[model samples]
Target: MIQVTPSIAIDESELEESFVRASGPGGQHVNKVSSAVQLKFDIRRSPSLPNDVAVRLMKLAGSRLTQDGVIVIVAQAQRSQKRNREEARERLLELIRAAAVRPQTRRPTKPTKASKERRLVSKDKRASIKAGRSKPGAD
Candidate 1:
């Protein structure tokens, strides 16, 4: 089980992991070993997460999320498969932990009287500057 927060714990069975050959800087070893880890979690079907957290997780996933609501995180920076796997799991846990927090709602506010007056004053100042640029009463 992965403990995301005090209230949220995800079962290990909920995650799916696959390994693929890593690309980039490693010489011959990179071609032979499957070091990249692709971690998948089904946010839509998970019983562990609350509805609100699940919704936020889907939104936070952005491009990595599939149409089926599965979030796919790819970790390949490490050369060892174990490290890559751990990295992927850590990322997923962090994402879930972030989603667990309730977002603060924004309170709408009207412009302050001082701010409105300042805006009008600036506009009037600009108008006066432009007025000065006009030709002086037909010379």
Candidate 2:
């Protein structure tokens, strides 16, 4: 089980991992060993994530989330499969933990009276400057 937070925990069975050959400067080892780890998590079916958290996860994931709502994360930075796998798990936990947070509701605020007055004053000044540019004969 992967615990993202105190309340959020995902079953290890739900995560699908795939190993593939990594590309980089590992010489013969990179050419032979399958070190890259692709971690796939289905956000739509995960019991650990709340409905709102799932929605936000989908939004935050963007193109990474498929039409079926599976979030795919690839970790290949490390040469060893174990390190790559750990990196992928860490990334998934971070993403899930971030999703678990509820964003503070933004209170809609209007411009202050002084600010509004300043804006109007600026606009008036600009308008007056433009007005002065008019030809004397054109009135």
Candidate 3:
């Protein structure tokens, strides 16, 4: 089981991982060994996530989420399969944890009266300066 938050825990079975050969930096070993880990988790189908969290997760996943609502995380920074696998799992947990937090509601506010007055005052000052710069008889 993977614990994302205090209230949210996902079962190990919920995560699916596949291994593929990584393309860079390992020289001859890179072609021979499958060091990259592809981790997939279905946001829509997961029984472990709350509806609100799942919705937020989908939004947060963005391009990472497939058409079928599966989030695909590919980890290839590490040369070893185990390191890459762990990195993928950690990333998934971080994403789920981020989705668990509810966003603060934005409170709309009008500009202060003093601020509006200041803005109008500044505009008038600028207009006067420009007016003073023009030829006196050219009005």
Candidate 4:
């Protein structure tokens, strides 16, 4: 079981991993080895995540998410397959951890009287500078 949070623990079976060739300038060895890891997690069908969290996770996924509600994360920075696999899992865990947190709602705020005054003062100063740039006024 993969523990994401105190309340959320995902089963190993829930994750699907596939290995593919890592594309780049790595010469002949790179052509022979499939070091890249592709990690897929189905958010909509997950039993471990709450509905709200699942929704957020899908939104957070953005382009990484497929039409079927599966998140695909590719990790290929490492040359070793094991390292790439670990990186992919770490990234998924990070995403899950981020999705688990509740966002604080912003409260409506009124500008302070002092701040308002300061804004007006700055506006007046700018106006004066512009006014000074003009030619002498007609008598």
Better model by TM-score: candidate 2 vs candidate 3: 3
Error of 1 at 19 (Å): 1.4
10 residues in a row with least lDDT, candidate 1: 130-139
Stretches > 4 Å off in candidate 4: 24-29
For 11-53, candidate 2 gives per-residue lDDT tens digits of: 9999999999989767899988999999999999988788999
Off by over 4 Å in 2: none
Kindly list the per-residue Cα lDDT of model 3 for residues 69-124, writing each as its tens digit. Answer: 99999999999999999999999999999999999999999999999999999999
* Residue 89 Cα positional deviation in candidate 3, in Å, after optimal superposition: 0.8
How much is the lDDT of residue 23 in candidate 3? 87
- Highest TM-score: which candidate? 3
lDDT winner among the candidates?
Answer: 3
Q: How good is model 3 by TM-score?
A: 0.93
- Model 1 over residues 3-32: C-alpha lDDT tens digits? 889999999999999999999767899999
Please give the lDDT score for candidate 3: 0.96
- The weakest ten consecutive residues by lDDT in model 3 span 1-10
What TM-score would candidate 2 get against the native?
0.88
